[model samples]
Target: MSGIILHHYATSPFSEKVRIAFGIKKLAWQSVDIPPVMPKPDLMPLTGGYRKTPVLQIGADIFCDTQLILRELERRHPTPTFYPGLARGLAEGVAFWADHQLFGAAVAIAFGAFGDKLPDAFLEDRSKFSGRNIDRARLKQQAAVMQGPLRAHLGWIEDALADNRAFLFGDAPSLADLAVYHCVWFVRERARSDALADYAGLNAWADRMKAFGHGERSDLDAKAAVAAARAAQPAPVRGTVMPNALGLTAGAMVSVTPDDTGRDPTVGELVALDAQSVTIRRSAPEVGEVHVHFPRAGFILVPAKA
Candidate 1:
């Protein structure tokens, strides 16, 4: 019901990415700290099924996935652009490498080094992942396997930085910088490893991103966030037909929900829709008092007849 509501937990690398973006954009947003693990009852009513971390909620509109969220933010505020014109493609390429490749290796190292040291409180919050304890020894072995690939990637990043562009693309900070920051922050905060210190340019870039400061980030308990979400009224459902990008016909009673992870899924009567996204209304309290949205690309709006 506020300007921006972010449902996320502390120490989530992806969440941190959005936090940094908010800081860079200088936007004030509400914080809704979701459970680190499963049984996210409060969040479910909004996302329907998608459970990925760091969901962005605006009024009744919920945006899942950090990439999509970032895109929305960019569309809203274009000044400090994350994708600066010609560099957009390059920035996206770097972000992809960082999210997939770099994050893969960073996570491997983090669990390998701090699996045991992880706070009991944090571990307990992850009820879903609680029983599946990490085998540090195995994690270490996995780290070894990942290390070579990560190091090679870092070396490539280092060479890019050697060009003295300030940011990965040059001059101003971009999405690539934020993606890289979260991974490096994970290594420093969780892993406590200075392995990246050897990469001077990368280190310097990290420092620059850090200078942005995590804007308006205040701690909120998961229960509190859930309570706030429950108390909040769902946005009014507009009667206009939604565009159909999913090849569904108007009047098709399909459930427009996010993909399962734990996040709330948006469900409604399939009105005007498209292959990209679908709009739904909360006809039942189970779906909450809000209009729900789903990306046709990622969700399945199964026709009620099926």
Candidate 2:
């Protein structure tokens, strides 16, 4: 319940999800700003191989992906629960749809709109990370094609807020608002687009979400974070063992990889497996032994040698 270390850069859209969750919960946390792109040497030690931004670390427990991290945060501090029964199903479904479809389109547009403005090194790193060539022409072309779908997506959201609801699902802000807000934040702030200006309802909703603010944060350097991980011990878990759906079991060597673009795997000794999450124990001289958690929803857990 101590040392809430967040390995995140300032502008990662997914990181904003976790940050907004922290704000909604009013959680106090420490920050370790990582690079926006790859070659995250300090972060690699704790995550084993996963290099995605905004990793959540508590003591020696490392959590990859915002989905898992937000749930963990909710678990640790559950006063204002994220899943209100009335809109739980709607909140989760719409959030997932937005996270993937809407988010992907926004990123494509950003790359296309400003790909030429990016530094060559940043473009090279993104290409390597994406496992594809950085085709500026292709991205620019895709940008034009993507606007229709993107606008349609936003229009749907605008209609959702047309009722003048305080939040997407209800009177109080929930994960649904947070999930959609980050992408809108990206298109408006990061990508610098006025696409939402015409949509009064969505623009107002975006303003309300933004006003929630990022929670308490204190900066920590990469070396300090590495040292913190080395000095800490993994948090104990009493998670019940369930059936091995993957034909795999605890103590097996496994690799946890995201199904999305960041296909890099985090390989370790499987310590716990359940329907919701998979925990793997990995060790490094710098970070000692760490248990990294990844949600089973968007990630794949497979035998290491497979």
Candidate 3:
């Protein structure tokens, strides 16, 4: 059985976060490249309706959301902890800000200031999605709104950097540092502007984090990855359920699937259960899958009404 399979796309910022974590932990994992847009047939059976990037699959168990995935990775591998003891609370706060606030700002800038900088090929690739032009316009508007908040947030981050700590919390890098680093990386790489140039400390911090190369990151075509996943047999469903503490149930029928661009299955019968996750078995040949699980807390599971 594969240890852990990550379904994600290259340009996804959230996926970048998990990729970096994999690098930090020095762990090897199977990579499943999902589409950047919708029409995700193969993935939906695993995720049900959640159409987010970067879903982690372990055997029959599927994990969505980067935050939960991070915790799971930490639990599986304790060394190089993302949540250092002294700065745990601070780290959590920073991560929250990055995922919501910083990411929001970065998205705005990505669509507004740096849209042209993206290679024509990149744009063309994304153009495959319906209503590409409309999406671009909306993204630009989002960028404009994000710019103001991001600038203010950057100012605050500058002051935080002034504390002379090697990281957000001290000499050691914490989840906060990584969260901040990836958001900044997206801005710098995608925006290609000096929006943050004025913040010397922030620049230095970003440079330091860059030294930790995301592990085994290579350009694998999205189509190829999907094909490989299709060719490979769905891993057997383990009877074990994600712990109840995680908040999933047994007997609830659900179709475990991903949310990106792949078609495998539409629905499945959710069987094996626990507090944390529920297992889904797909009948569709294209979606023939087993033990698709979702985190109880992050996902909504409505009992199949008779």
TM-scores for the candidates: 0.78, 0.95, 0.73
Give the higher-lDDT candidate: 2 or 3.
2
| Candidate 1 lDDT by residue in tens digits, 174-278 | 988888888888887768876666888888888888888767755555455444545566555334454445556655667654443233334556544544445
- Which lDDT tens digits does candidate 3 get at residues 90-193? 77677877877788678678667767466655566555532244355466777767777888887777788898777777777778877887788788875676
Backbone clashes under 3 angstroms, per model: 25, 0, 31
What does the lDDT come to for candidate 3? 0.66
Candidate 2 displacement at residue 108 in angstroms: 1.8
Clashing pairs in 2: none
Name the better of 1 and 2 by TM-score. 2
Candidates sorted by TM-score, descending order?
2, 1, 3
Best by lDDT: 2
Instruction: Sort every candidate by lDDT, greatest first.
Output: 2, 1, 3
Predicted candidate 2 versus true structure: per-residue lDDT over 1-306, tens digit per residue? 357889998778999888888888888889888988778889999999898878999878999988788778878898687876576667777788888999988887777767778887887887877788887668788878887888999888888888888788778887788888888888887888766679888888888888878889888787888888788888886574478767777788999898977799889988888878989999998889999999888888888985
Candidate 2 C-alpha error for residue 166, in Å: 1.0
Q: Top TM-score: which candidate number?
A: 2
Whole-model lDDT per candidate: 0.70, 0.84, 0.66
lDDT of 3 at 232: 53
Model 3 scores a TM of 0.73
Q: Which has the higher TM-score value, candidate number 1 or candidate number 3? A: 1
